[model samples]
Target: MIGVVSNSRHASDYSQGVRAMADFARKCLDNWVLTVNGSFEQHQKMIRATLAKRAYELFELRGREHGLHLEDWVIAEQELVHHNLNGNSSGFCILVDCPRDPGIITILSVTSRSLLVFQSRAMADHNPELIAVHLLPENIHPEQTAVDAVDGVLQVHLPKQRNKRRK
Candidate 1:
């Protein structure tokens, strides 16, 4: 009887620990943001490659059917741009490692599809100007988005846009 009681207690403790760890992770990710290099143009290339891959998968799913390239591409976009592969709707968080001191930070634009940021450090002798852009996987409310810089890390909290259907 004592052994069974100890096992039950241990299981309860383990469950509590798991919950606590999940809560800690969520809190840590609350201020998470995606950081990008100075190369903004590369985002386009990456998007094209990803889209191509998804489109090809659609083609294979269609039993290697041809002449549906445009349709496949559109379908792929609808699948990927709206929802991630995992289909989790809790929003997305990406952490970007930055310098200890990022200097003056400026946000150029925040759209539903992407974010454009400009950072400048006049005091620095090298690379005084840097432009970074991050492409979002889902549409977000531009007005509701919050951007902040903490400890040289840029944190962007993006709230996903809700879809409303009219009756």
Candidate 2:
């Protein structure tokens, strides 16, 4: 993950913001070791907690209105998930569950508005490769983005681009 950030405008230029995942793999294979405790269940729990807090806030905002609990929860989920996907200026985090093993290689590409994951070695015999592409909500600061893989999960921190204020 130690490489010069490129300034290329090409869509394939994954090196512009985040260091290529290939570099991470190479370093890990050589000597770099990352020890982190994370899992898909943990990610789900956090999401639920966030949703609950947001729903409660919405309830309070509505003057503590009754009989709209389900509605509030739904609205909160929509807002948070949409905001996370659409790109809020405050940024967001995404968690991906992936197996961590020497035999598997995961190639990832990230840009200002999207994330692409391609697993070279499929975990199952029926599938030769696994590919996933996610569209971001809005433009992001690729350089400020961070990604971590721990305990069969990947956590990507996407920082939204700051608006330049004119004086």
Candidate 3:
């Protein structure tokens, strides 16, 4: 009778462990779906704004020479799209080793005029490799922001600029 009781107890414990693991797995899946959906929406918005900003920069780069506005805009859009697809920006890529678990790899916090990237620790720990590219607004200076690698993920804080009204 004692042996049967011991076996029964062991079985109960094993079943409980399995149920707990299943619940955890389900939670992780839900979180992953939400993160991916959010990232896609944010990326769409950023791409539009970034393309316009880059086009303007290109126009300025050519000494403000006239008649190439359309060309500049097209080129800027193409370049930005290509860079994002390839995950390689000329000089704006940050690489870090992250964990395989996914919770929130890239978190974009956007206000009226600024954007911020916040990364979670779990997302940084098991991936073993991570690449992050940050695009800043035209008016904000890069020198004004700060980049820190905490808990294996890169965190960038971009302060927003207030536009002064002209009288």
Top-TM-score structure, candidate number: 2
Count: clashes, candidate 2: 5
lDDT digits (tens) for residues 1-167 of candidate 2: 11222234453322222222322222222112221212223223334665677789899999999999999999877764433353345996777556555555554445576555544342333211224444566777655666677777777777888788999
| Candidate 3: clashing pairs of residues | 98-124, 98-125, 98-126, 98-127, 99-124, 99-125, 99-126, 99-127, 100-126, 100-127
TM-scores for candidates 1 onward, in order:
0.37, 0.44, 0.30
lDDT of 1: 0.45
Winner on TM-score (2 vs 3): 2
Which structure among the candidates has the greatest lDDT?
Answer: 2
The lDDT for every candidate, in the order shown, is 0.45, 0.51, 0.37
Q: How would you encode candidate 1's per-residue C-alpha lDDT over 9-70 as one tens digit per residue?
A: 24333222211221211111232322322322333444455567779989999999899999
Residue-level lDDT of model 3, residues 28-130, one tens digit each, is: 2211211111132344444555566778889899998999989998887666433321122222323333334554443333332233333344333321111
Q: What is the lDDT of residue 16 in candidate 2?
A: 24
Model 2 scores a TM of 0.44
* Model with the higher lDDT, candidate 1 or 3: 1
Off by over 4 Å in 1: 1-90, 102-108, 122-130, 148-150
